[model samples]
Target: MWGIEAGSVAQDTASGQYAGLAPSIDSWFLSQSASTASVSKMTAAREAGAVPMVAWSPEGNLTEIKNGQKDAQIISMAKSLAAYGHPFYFRPFAEFNTNWETYSLGRSGNTPQALYGAWRRVFRIFRQYTGSKSLFVWTVGYSGSISPLKTAWPGSDYVNYVGIDAYDWCTSSSWCPGDQYRYKTMLGALRQFDGGRPAILAETATGLQTADKGKWLGAALRTAQADGIRALVWFDEIVPNSNQPDWRLASPSSAQASIQAALKQPNVASPKYRDITTLESYAVSASWAKAIR
Candidate 1:
């Protein structure tokens, strides 16, 4: 699936519409509370012909969740999603091996056992309500060596898809003083550790500083296809005052052209291309009429 995690369905769909590409999956975040209010976003995505992929962060102690403190919240989410009645993707505690996440295995005294327990608990509850209609995605931030990713797996039975968030955060030696930035290599590693499940690039983008960014984008997509990735979602945001590099193709027009070329390939799925084109056209025409007035 060719997908994007961005501001809105219109925005996300527009990202690829010019190329006759629309997201097969529209990825978004569910806050620490795991609010079902975001169902509105999911509704919009579905209306536009895409499945919703929620990256949920159930903040606070993982052990507490394992011990059932968050059972109410989990059940609420599961029932709400089940009532929605359309298939979607649930990705909870993404990047669980990264130090930055509050629920990370080694952070705040969280153990691998706690992670496992918490995940299984959530998975079991969701299954009770959603059944096999929805899929549980387990995603990790790629760590080049000696990573806790495999150790943190909740098990094959609990997870339907395995994914990695691989970013090219380094272009200058100053940012990556150790020269450790590996975009393509990380994509290569995803297939090996997917636990025999379908693989996805959950979040990815090259830094703005990289030379020939357009070429890199094209090559990355081709690499993902070659690696047997079932889905790839571009992290196409330009956050204000953030440490992350600008990965939006909107800023540099040429990068969009390159992505367009890559997306033209038959393997890249864009189920909502017509809907996106209509939306884009309406917006443009509305703007033109306002200008003439």
Candidate 2:
């Protein structure tokens, strides 16, 4: 549940003030892709000149640790980026609706076009390095209303999939605290924009539980089944030394039951929704090309 995709490992020192990080942190961050430890490293970097100052970019800047680890996640990204090149899944600072991380929070003067351009730069770099159909995903945070859709969207060539980062909150309020992000509910909303490729829960908070976590879990599954979202990823923050609960969800043993139960029901597949039957469809373009499977 906890994974770290380290790129160019850097020493956490501005001249020996001991930036609160451990030597291992420096040892790991400073490792390069070429080093024996980084023999298999890969990094997701944010191409400079892409996003505009009008927008915000946080987690979006996946520092291409020149010495990125050559593991599953890192290698996968490297393979995709080096092969398909630019215009890949440029989902930078998605889910602006949620104030979780600096990457995705609020927007003031930036237009979607400018945001789109920034993202395109990433994909373009990937394309330049990879190939076509790099499969870039533009996802939003979840468990609440989607406000970014109201803004401008990137051009057709730049984006491939539209997704959201939904968590399991009892009711649709804020983060998925007590009530886990019921899979069913999240899937239900995903169905609204079904055009197919694959509607995804780009990021999800799980493992932690409140009183009604189980209920939320049950409802989430049902919702996903009814809606047809194709994929989901549980973002269990497991970075060493960072005890901040913001990105970290509960990993307590008590919540294992709920986590196990959710994992068991994996086939919450969708056929991609088409047609603007609902008002929500109109807002979120229900098209196959818009969906990145």
Candidate 3:
């Protein structure tokens, strides 16, 4: 299915455009630190007929989560989701293989074992409190090292979907602008570790480094479809940092035209989304929930 991480932009603008092209739209929620769950965001997405996907970052110590110091806070968030009574995609501590996140192995005093313990603790807590209403997604940054990626896995039992966050930023003098890569080339290696689980392009965007974003978008969609990727969620936002190029897709641009054309393809449009109820079945299944215990 097609979706977007609206970032700071209004969800209506991002979702409305996609809804015009596809039968269903997916909305993303990114929570930084230990903020309370935003039930209203989920409600707004559902009201607009979009499925909500949330990425929750603790932004604090990973050891606290593993040691149960954050149980109350985490459980409170899970309860709010359960009360909503609908299935939603839940990803915690995303990009853990990179140095940017607090829970990542590159952080001081953190290790692969520490990340695994923290993830399992959070996963088990949510599974206990929310039942099958939450679909756990394990996401890693596309730029992370392959060795760290293998070591940081929380195991297949705790994850429902394997996701990768990648972006195509043509070229910039500040960073390696010429280091751009195609969709399949960036994702091919990671997909091998998916363990037969469905995969998602959880977060992605292409910068205007190239004059024609449309061609870039078309190529990306074609690659994703050919690789059997289950979904792609565009990160539709402008990075506030001055050094970063705006990643938002603008109207009257070739990139926008390419998106419109690519989304019209049968393989990309009108997704047969899995019912949220399927989460409940997975939650209670021996194969899926065994590790949670």
Q: Which candidate number would show the highest lDDT if scored against the true structure? A: 1
lDDT for each residue of candidate 1 in 1-293, tens digit (9 for 90 to 100): 67888878888888757545778778887678664635577788878877777888565779988999888888888887887666777888888877778887777888878888999998999899988756888877786332555566688888888778888775443454322234345545544555577677888876755345556666677777676666778888887998877877664565566666666665555563434333333222211111110
What lDDT score is found at residue 47 in candidate 3?
56
Worst 10 residues of 2 by lDDT: 46-55
RMSD of each: 8.4, 13.8, 6.2
Candidates in order, TM-scores: namely 0.83, 0.49, 0.82
Score candidate 3 by TM-score against the native: 0.82
lDDT of 2 by residue, 171-270 (tens): 3324544443344453454445433435555555443334234345445555544565533433444456854332222334344355445434433211
Off by over 4 Å in 2: 1-80, 83-90, 96-109, 143-150, 155-157, 169-197, 206-215, 238-250, 266-293
lDDT of 3 by residue, 1-293 (tens): 66776652255445446434422335556565554677776766665555677888555577777788888888778787777777778888888877877777767677777788888888998899887768888887888766766566778888888777888765432554433244454466665665777677788777664445655666676677667667677776766757766776663253555656656555543223323333234322312211110
Stretches of model 3 off by over 4 angstroms after superposition: 8-15, 18-25, 171-188, 191-193, 209-211, 251-254, 269-293
| Model 3: per-residue Cα lDDT at residue 220 | 72
lDDT against true structure, model 2: 0.37
